[model samples]
Target chain A: MSASSERWPLRKLIFDTLFFAYGVALFADALGAMGVSAFHFTQDDFIQNFSHYATFSLLLTGVMAIVALVANLRGWTTPGDALFASPLRKLELSARPWSRSPWLWQVVIVFTLTIVVSVRVTESSIGDLLDADGLQGAWRLWSGLSQPNFNLLPRALALAAETIFIAFLSTVLAIPAAFFLAFFAAKNLMQGPLALAVYAVLRALLNLSRSIEPLIWALIFTVWVGVGPFAGMLALTVHSIASLIKYYSEIIESVSDGPIDGIRSTGANAIQTVWYAVVPQIVLPYIAMTVYRWDTNVRMATVIGLVGGGGIGTLLIQYQGQALWPEVGCIVLVIAVIVWLMDTASAYVREALK
Target chain B: MSASGSPLLNVRSLGKTYPNGTKALSDVSFSVDAGEFLVVIGLSGSGKTTLLRCLNRLVDPSYGEIDFAGRRIETLQGAEVRSVRQDMAMIFQQFNLVPRLSALTNVLTGQLAHQPTWKSLLGLHSSTEREAALEFLKLVGIADKARVRCDQLSGGQQQRVAIARALYQKPKLLLADEPVASLDPATSHSVMDYLRKANRELGITVICNLHYLSLVREYATRVIALKEGRLVFEGRPEEIDRAWFQRIYGEEARDVGIQ
Candidate 1:
């Protein structure tokens, strides 16, 4: 028999212990780097700031660890094993098909360790979030939501319309370019060495552009287009084009080859093949996906305004900056209503297409 | 086989070796006359499909000498090749209709080769073309389902629609690659009957691949058998006997009748 299939629980236990010790040492090193003598028992000042909560947390963790160790040594499973078992099975949640599979325990241990490491690295505390000044400010913000300045309704409505128009115009501008890019990027359509090279280049370019958020694009365009809805439209168009190409190409890629071969065998030209076969299959999905993009762009339009790309968001930022709570409340109400309307409309269109 | 005048299609020393080193067809020479319902019989991977596709230049032959209507079709390029395909309509086992489109529209797409670029793009069909499409649909016995989506139709009905589409091409030669493979025994006869009707009534030459020897016996005016990419037998359908089947299929192969 091979050594790999051998039952060596003792060796595994030793490796697991070594890994646990390494984690503890790493955590201490991090704390020490942050000027906390976390592992030094001789430090006189360390215990003063440790607090009662810290001591209780440490005691609880130590007890849990001991229980896990004892359970593992006795060849019995722990609660951690049950917690990481297949989530799909209701009655057989704790049942393991292969008792020797180590993925469950490894995942549970890694996940818990990640949470602790993240919290320590961020140096965040619950007390700072519950501070009196922060709580008071939050309360004040909530209170302003009760009374909106209805007198600014007309201006708010106009700005809301402008935001929607920005989204619509940008989506329209992006679609045709994305449509052309999709065919070139689709692996089924683009063959040969040169065409494949073009496909790769286009995919890389689209991925790079899409990886940046619309807000970042808006900021860059605001600098170029001089702070207006034009900047917002341009920014949204660029981001929408990159993202829609990916979606459109995926649809094109997965399209059934039956119709394509049917059209091709008819001696239909390349353009005719796409128009007759490819276009029919993709039309409904393209419309539904583009409508979805338009809905997302409506939401993005408001956010872009904070960067001076113009819309209801610009008014929102202005009123909120001056602490004119009533005007800010009015803009927020108008934006919410319009966004809700767009969402409902797009959802209806998508459902109808399906 | 008398040494008569020139045949409509003459193929000599045809061969196809795929890039993956699979020899799909080798030294396959055959002649097809006009208005003949020729059936190709073979097991899977015996180059029947490849031979049919190569007839319309769907799969380019690595080396071949093909003369269609006294023209050296093997050396034709671009528009000339496309024009040759326009005259040779091909149908598939899967009934490759654009599933989303109405059966009538899928049939209308067969006229794409004859239409102008602008008209085809605009999906503009003349009243006469529309009438002709419906007539073909009626001929296939699916005129009532012409307005229905092709995907919603049964396998037999979809194959009829495919036949209707091929009729719209007004092709001189029809190549069918296992057109009834997906249908039941009765439905298979029904679809094959339509092809036989087209060949007899419209004077269209058909070369089709058939899996069932019984179907070949019933429908084929002339029959050819292939084994391991080589043409093993060629004669009238009634000439293929148990010894011939053994030679074509292999020693261990048993003849399975469909009916």
Candidate 2:
């Protein structure tokens, strides 16, 4: 057989060692669980549980082994006429242009190692985690899925309105603040220590606001302003600043500096420079970003509501705590529908802007 | 408009050393008479752009006095500088029209100095000003594309539109910095033709920087050559010979200019 057809010795050795180790670990665990003593490993209750739990995993490994075997068989070649026909083997193939690439082989080795390790780690008994009592409770929960209570519809609609209001208010508030911060951050627009200081301050503020999730912001606002949509709006506004600042700054940075220089050459003051050059270039992008942020804020508003910033999630939380499964499902469905519609509308608006 | 009047622009010992300590222009002194078409030529880093920009105080000269139309521009501050800039319109290599704005809107932006800040912000231009913008657009030969966005046009057409915008400013002096560098040969010729026409018809003192010696030879009445931030040659186009160009551009001249 040709050298290419021959099995790689190191690969074969590593595969065999891993397979043996897995088998030993499974056998040891099974023996210990069955209360077996000494070196003798017996097949008993532990073996039954282990085999039942690991049936799917064992099937997967067996399929992988079969596929590898087939690949090996395909690579095999006869020795006769191999010298002239398989000239690639005789030539310095490693010196070829493509042979310099090591990333492909690295990925293959890493993937194979991960699969082997995963198979070994998950071979023990786990069926007890899904016992009859546990399964029965899950079945009961699933069976409760039916029409939601129509009586709560009014409250749901009101909360939905609150969520929309919060999102709208917050997005509007964030835009102007982000606009100034973005100009400060753009390297082409500003230079030196002042620019650096402004950038650092803006970046720190953005990170600080975003680092504390909207849920945490809602909680803090609830304590400060009392539980209402106003609290929710304040929370969304702060969070929106963080998101908009990053997006606005990126847009500012990408703007063609040509017009800016042209305007500056006209002896247009700083404010005039921004109005004439920067604003004209970034207006469309800014509008698109605002619409997208509004959509995101709408989703976040609902989430924050669960923490007492009033919205649809607050009502959903109440129903969930009372085991109103059908109502919970309905609320989830409503949220999904709203998000999908908003996403589609936002996409259309963005396309129109472009 | 008198033929023997004082020069429209005067520069004395103009020098610029950037923040990074690189000298862009040094000891540059020149003057342009009213209604003069002076073309400046130089190598890539020869500081022609810096010198032109210093006329309006765009690039603040480290040591100089720029007196344009009898006004001391080098000492002007804030509104005073803006007033001088209003009288001096600049055209760039890239055309520099706001891409998103329509050609008409871009032209109207030149009238920004004349309009109230709030009125301009609201985009409320007087009907007469709008009509004048349209007239200038027609003069530049793209009046049909008045409502079209600038990005929709070819490079040459955009540069024409930029020239029209500069005309809309009604400036006494026009500065064009490599205005035809981005265009092909035919387009470059057409743009230079429009610039020459504007200079003659409007009586605007034109100071243009050109890289192509042939274009300068064909169009400019007076040519100024700068080398290493200093004026190396200054005379009428007829006076610029092979030896004079070689002195200014060195070995690179054999590859450049009309062959």
Candidate 3:
């Protein structure tokens, strides 16, 4: 990500020329727009390009400049002992004869204007945030939430248990799958063309699965499996596999090569070396990640049930649809308890391991 | 032991060109005799590590023959290569002990290749194997500290455990890749003394790569100097005078003797 500008003089020149042309064109256009002095430039629209070529030329020239900068920083550029070494001696913007103000002031104005424009485009209104009627409706919902609903308590407790189980099962299934895939996905483990190919394929598959949210996966699985906790667990499983693979593989890649090499030197073959050296180092971390993923999966499972994928959310949504706030309150309490318990359990397990 | 007394290891025109096109070593050849403490000395990036790696087939030589213990190592592959590696134990500059593991467990790793694959993976060593590993820890004078995690151990203690691990391999040759490079001056000598003990008492051939000429002169029965991937000198340590030292490690280089 670093380069020497000296290495690619031509690229630097191209970048300089484009940037210089843009500044000059803008300056000249501004002068003409103001009907000022001897700068006889004309413009149909204020912002539209009188020199549109300058903007487009920037795309290529900017890339070249970055490449040169990176090369220079990386020490790739050597001292040129040839002809045509003469580049622009100094590139000072303040020294430009036509410059009326510092570039920093212009940049500040541009950024401020961009934020102002964004605010207008988004149509945000602070005045509407605390509207009287909405406040009245919020009071009703708040009053209902405050009241107890012991009638739905038994059902809510069952749903809470089911939700936690869904998370547990999904994470349990994902762990072994992720554990195996991580070895293949790790850069250090993947040697030779075939292994690299497998790595790329596995990485692509993981990325594809991980990109979609568990809610979306739940929706698809709900359609396939027909609206149940089974669909929710399946959705969580897919996401956990991808997430765990990423976590596990990165840890695997970052493991100290010293111990691995030491084991290898002892004449352990590739499998033996990994089994003996790599496993011991990574096992503790892998267990921690498994617990972490299960925690995440539980959070995801709660949301998945909002789409009729089971748990207390399904019961809460059903009651809320009928405007049954007392029943909804019961389900919400159950969910809070479930989450707190999971958080405590995972933390305790992690602390105990250490 | 090779009673015939031919060189335990030999190299003929060993050369290595890495994938990125850096020639780490070129046309370098040397042989290690049985029961001799040989030292390889050079500045960093002078192919010392690469040479040790090649001897164990951790990195294969690009061309030329490596004859080790009468075995043609340069041509070795797969199981053949792995089996041959067991005979040559290597201790590294970093100590390379698995920090999280206990010192005893790290030493047990030295016997990983010698035992059944399933047993090593399960870490289910026999009581006899455990006793032998304990004996190695005792040899390195850290038997009392066997159950302590390697990361908790001092730098010198960790290195002693590393030496114990190497000795546990019961190897024909001990390849020390700047074994004391990471240690303090006092600890460096202590570690070197263990290597000397392994060579003198245990009769293990030691091919140690070192930076300090003082350590080389003190320990080495024979010495080989590598400069820019080529063997520049191969003679007795005392023969390397101030003039010869300049020739081996360029004129600008001064030997920073470690006390």
Candidate 4:
């Protein structure tokens, strides 16, 4: 017997209870479906349907159970000496048989055949695949290359510029604000009830801003700022503050306590400690995170513009509504290029900072 | 102010109790004359570090006064404290040079108190200060690695850079807290040698906390020992024999407490 079995009969008891409960539930459901009035069945019609399905399910279940039992019994086990060796050595010793186990091959064959049969059952005709209502149209929608139009270039460029501008302006404004909030949030810097209160407020504000997606924020800002890049910028700014506060606080927490302790030991005041020590340690990571946030905001700006917040998404939406597939394709291409460029530039700047 | 004659640092009955209610130092009294090389030795948690930090008011004492150069540091506030810090320097066991900064820049940071915050932020050190920093780096024998980032240096080299930074401050007192505790045997001697040279040549009072009894005997002119946050021994290096150390360390101090 295994160590677990020798130690307690708890495992056997649990297994027996579960097995009995499962069988009882299964039998009760079957009888109830057969119009057993004592358990409340609506009609005897269920008896005919239940009998057919239950017989089929029973055959399938029995075959699966026997296969599982055979597979478990046939699996390989290492010798006692090998099993008791250091974990790494034991792993190496046991790996060969484990890999070559017959059940592994059986499982692979079963999975492959299941997929093949599924594909055959679900397969559609090539004519239907090529039809405008089917796979061909879906492919065109995905690639945006089946029909290409260059006429939307100017509008797309303008919207892309708007997206970049909004992201840049908002991120710039959010950085310093996040810095202050993060300082208050850091436990080493601020202590006591007042600090805790400030932390709670900042956390709530972060959650509130992030909870309402940027698109929703854009809609709200559109009402306030009258629907332009300005509204988009405002929305992105609020969202960036929420995101950056979390990132900046984590960065502040990871900063080396040495410099902070050194400053405090010098009898420097609290503000001085933050200015001299905390700021120095976090400066590089802060700049890197700010650049990353700007890149993410640019991507979000495009999505926000679908609701008239002013970006490439606006141009794409216009073409889409007009059924000008080629024009929409052109707009999407421009957006992709802009996003890729921003991502590459962000990576380059991050590397330089490191 | 001439660095002469008078004791550079004076501590009278200093006591510190942490917020968690652990008493770090109690009734500690010590004074170092100008240019004296004082080394404090004790087992771990014996408040040797607490005493040294109390001199610079780094870890503020809960009760008592520390007077450095006739000014009571424990009572100093704001700019007064900054002024005092400008006049004193500390070296850490970890050689806490800003790892991302060049060795020269680390040394320049020592002069930050003298400059406007704007200048320090912009890294606009005066040309004279820059030259002096290089000169001090040469004194510590790492001038060639001036432009190298601190992380690239070996432990001993990093400690040397730390010493150079403290030297650039032109401090009246250099408080080193177990400066060589993290270093290997060979490197520890070199670091101690530089500290001794600074003490003898520049008349800088070098007060250090050391774990090694042999190193303390070789380096320090005056030795101070503590046990459980109280002053237990104060005498010349020759007077700190096996019996005196036994009294200071007791049964708990085995390999660490004896020479």
Scored by TM-score, the top model is: 3
Give the per-residue lDDT of model 4 (tens digit) for A1-354.
455543333443333333333343344444554466343233364575787557755664565444433432453222222323346545655576756644345445545554544444465457776777777677767666556677767877887898899889999999888887888766666566888788778777778778999889889999998877888888999989889988998888898877665555443455656776678778988999999999999899899888878877777778898777778878878888999999999999999999
Say which prediction, candidate 3 or candidate 4, comes out ahead on TM-score. Answer: 3
lDDT of 4 by residue, B174-217 (tens): 88999999998888899999999999999888889998888888
In candidate 2, which residue pairs get closer than 3 Å at backbone N, Cα or C atoms, i.e. clash? none
Q: Mind giving the per-residue lDDT tens digits that candidate 1 earns over A71-158?
A: 5556454334344323442235445554444545654665666666567658688998999999998878877865889998999899
TM-score-better candidate, 1 vs 2:
1
| Quality of model 3 by C-alpha lDDT | 0.82
Residue-level error in angstroms, candidate 2, position A118: 15
Looking at model 1, the pairs that clash are none
lDDT of 1 at B208: 94
Tell the DockQ for candidate 2: 0.37
lDDT of 2 by residue, A179-279 (tens): 77777766666766887887788678778878999889889999999998889889999889888988988898899988877766655666767788888
Q: Candidate 2 iRMS, in Å?
A: 1.7
Interface RMSD of 3: 1.2
Q: Per-candidate DockQ versus the true complex?
A: 0.58, 0.37, 0.67, 0.23
**Candidate 3's residue-wise lDDT over A1-354, tens digit each?**
123535556644444444444444455444554567455333344246645645655654676456445544563321221122333422333244533433344444445555554454465678666888878888888788778588889898888888889999999999899998899999998988999999999999989999999999999999999999999999999999999999999989989999888988888878778886788789888888789788878778888999978887787788889988777877888888878888888888878776
Model 1 lDDT, residue B230, Cα: 91
Q: Which pairs, if any, clash in model 4?
A: none
B174 Cα displacement, candidate 3 (Å): 1.0
Model 2 residue A267 distance off true place after TM-score fit, in angstroms: 4.4
Question: Best candidate, DockQ-wise?
Answer: 3
